[model samples]
Target: MCWKTLLCCSLWLLLLKSNENLAFKIPSIDFEMLHELGFEVSIPDEPGMQRVFYMLQIDDNCPALMDYITESNNGSWISRQKTSLQNNDKLQISVLVQYNDEIYEKSETRVIINARLLTTRDGRSQSITYPNGEGECHAYLSPQKQAKRCKPAQSIVSSSRQTCQGELLFEDNFSEAQLNRSTWKHDIRQRMYHVEEELVAFDDAPRNSYVKEGYLHIVPIVASEVVEGSFKLGDRCTAVESPEQECNIAQGSFYSIKPPVFSAQIHTRDSFSFKYGKIVVRAKLPKGDWLFPYVMLQPVSTYAETHYAKQLRVAYARGNSHLQSNQQEDISGSHLYGGMVVWPHGRAMQYLKDRLSKAHYGDSFHNYTMIWQRDKITLMVDEEIYGELYEGLSFFNEKCFIIFGVTVGGFLNFDDSVLAKDVKPYLNREPRAALSFWQQRDTWAPTWGKHSSMIIDYVRVYAE
Candidate 1:
């Protein structure tokens, strides 16, 4: 019986000692360390900040509190890293507490100075609490720099007007002396193959097709020299190749390298391709008649026949147009072929020609844009929605990049008299009588030049 009583007494003593040694939790910030650390604080509603406040319970074995300051790289400001120190110079936080003939101690707040950039683990530029209940009250450094959604999207107005102001995945500035030597490639082959090359030649034509003020101007040269060369594999033009065939040509233009060959079709296919987003190009239109203005957006999928070009003819033939008659120049059904001739086959091309004939083109520099969502593809010229293809079109099943270029004449014929007169002297031609009748005629005046050039100002793309 006495042994049992002694055992219970010893157990009670051990419990008392255990309770005495155990430490308790403490608050984050202490009043005394604020001056040394040089911290500024403000409460949401209060005039000043709270220096000390009892939060939850504390831990026992933690050492005393110490505070230290770390300034920014430019020495603009100072913030606290550690706020507690004990006899051993060990860092910790201590909370004040009182009990009858006893006092408990534990590090209160774990101060962090010189924190990494705003991250999930580090709380942020403002106050944060750790999963373990330790915390630091950091003052709000700066208001977040918000980004404005593009017009018509109803997004917040952000300060970024320049192209560099958004989430940019890739950017290449072509400041190199020889732009062709940089991120560009050419397809010298004689067939229509989409070459996965980035470096594009806009007016790789003769001296008349030079890039000035960021726009590639395609003008005529009357020196019997054919303006036929283009970046990669493309046709050229010459005066002799004019449709009239009556004028002994001084110079003719052609993309003669090959039809459907990888001409100046620059793309980010193998290197990079985006999923869903918008691309905005601030540019002006290329002038001159017989000009073929085009932008190509092609989407590829691992599921489709990668090597073979999906016959858009078959796709569009599902409509009223038959495939055989569709191929002819004067056929009414030939309207869809305009979309098919470009390298990257898709609806973006189909809508562009219709958009160009609208009132907004040629007169001003406008934003030629493409908005690709999961369900729809929209083509816009100057903020006006020209065409929209629903998700039903198979070409838009995958994401794509932007490709743009201009040609003197390929499949479409603009035999307008004003255009012909403007073009006649450069390549000696028979002056036609009826300008309006020629303009209405449907004939493909293929530019027979070897090298030609197209121009652009700036290209920008954005993602969510």
Candidate 2:
């Protein structure tokens, strides 16, 4: 009887010890210390990580587990190497969720690392709770004997681009002292029935498009300033297969004399086109009333009558410092806009607009960027991303070529309901749009000042 009683007591004590080890809460988890170390875990989302709160500092008796987790650099652990006072930062894994029940109920709120440091005779324990709470994971790394690895249903690679993933596909420093004609084709087409309804006609004149010092500048000149009366482009026009009407124009009635403005427009429609990648453009927006400066991507094979249709705008800004939306908020050179537009099967024009406001984008150069991926697209100005779109628009799924230009007096961007209508000369429906715009030049021209050029420093595209 005494022997049996002792056996029972020993088994009970062992069970108690086992429970204590399993109940171990996360250690070295002082948020104050984390702040002191300048180490951050997602109380909120960070770039590249959305709602993921993993960044844990823990001491491990198991060096094998620590090394595997830290070195893997994989999402299975969601970890990074960090430090503590004793420098006992063995493994980094974030466990405690902020515990928002409502958010957790809707989507995945947490991924637990159940590091069960249990005593095994072999010194390797099994634990590493996956997202779905399966029991297959073990503490030690096993090569052949492992969990099920699943492959995605669709291929992520794009068929149009043959470049290696993450490779630099295209880059231009604009330091050559001239536009690389092989890469950039000047667009000097006359605005007729099937072109942009802009008030300007692009031309290849040296003053309108040139490389000065090390920068590529696309400057806009008043047609009346370049020529006292009607201007003639003649054969210097770069647009191929242009019609005879493109040769000359004389100021006349409401069909609207020659284009009131002359600007430089350039694109890489033939030299380069890609399916999906990241694009970065360093540029300063032109500051001039009624002027439009844009960095965008155009469909290589398809064409849209509206310039903004079926295109992805990296950065677009109106030169007017006083323009406002129907809501009365300023929407001019002070604001940077980026978006993707699609005319969905003539159903309706569908677009997603993103805007960021500062004192003025023209005051200094800004980095405009677009990250185009298989599932998402992100637009950013400098360090701040102001726009994102998911797999909603099919227009973004195909290949596109890069385009940079400074255009003038397009009615779609400058809305009719703008509060600055007193200064705005032409509405979208005006029959003689160009005539009305030129007639009001007295009110808008002075605002152009000496800042009537769009300066580009560089453009780069990278494959994803």
Which candidate gets the maximum TM-score versus the true structure?
A: 2
lDDT of 1: 0.31
Report every candidate's CA lDDT.
0.31, 0.58
Against the true structure, what is each candidate's TM-score?
A: 0.38, 0.63
lDDT, residue 71, candidate 1: 20
Give the lDDT of residue 240 in candidate 1: 20
lDDT of 2 by residue, 1-464 (tens): 22123224542233222232232222222222231122322223222322222322233222222111212133332322232111123343433221211111011112112111212122122222344433222332222232221211221223442453335578898888678999888877555322236778887789998887778899988866422465566667554443455645665544647677888788887788887777889888899888898688878765322333577888888888767776778787887777775666643243555675766777788889887777877888874678788845566666788888888876566656554565578765667666777888888888887687999988888655
Q: How far is candidate 1 from the true structure (C-alpha RMSD, Å)?
A: 19.0
**Residue-level lDDT tens digits of model 1 in 1-464:** 22123224542232233336334322233322231122232112111211221222112222211222222223222223322211122122322222232333333233333111111122212211343335432221122221222222211112323332124444433333333323332211221122211111223333533345445443332222123433232243111222222111122232112122112334444444555555665544433333444444445343111233321211110111111222233311222211322235532233222332323133345666665555665656555565665634555445454444443332222322323233221221222212221232233122223222344555655543
Clash pairs, model 2 backbone: none
RMSD after CA superposition, every candidate: 19.0, 13.3
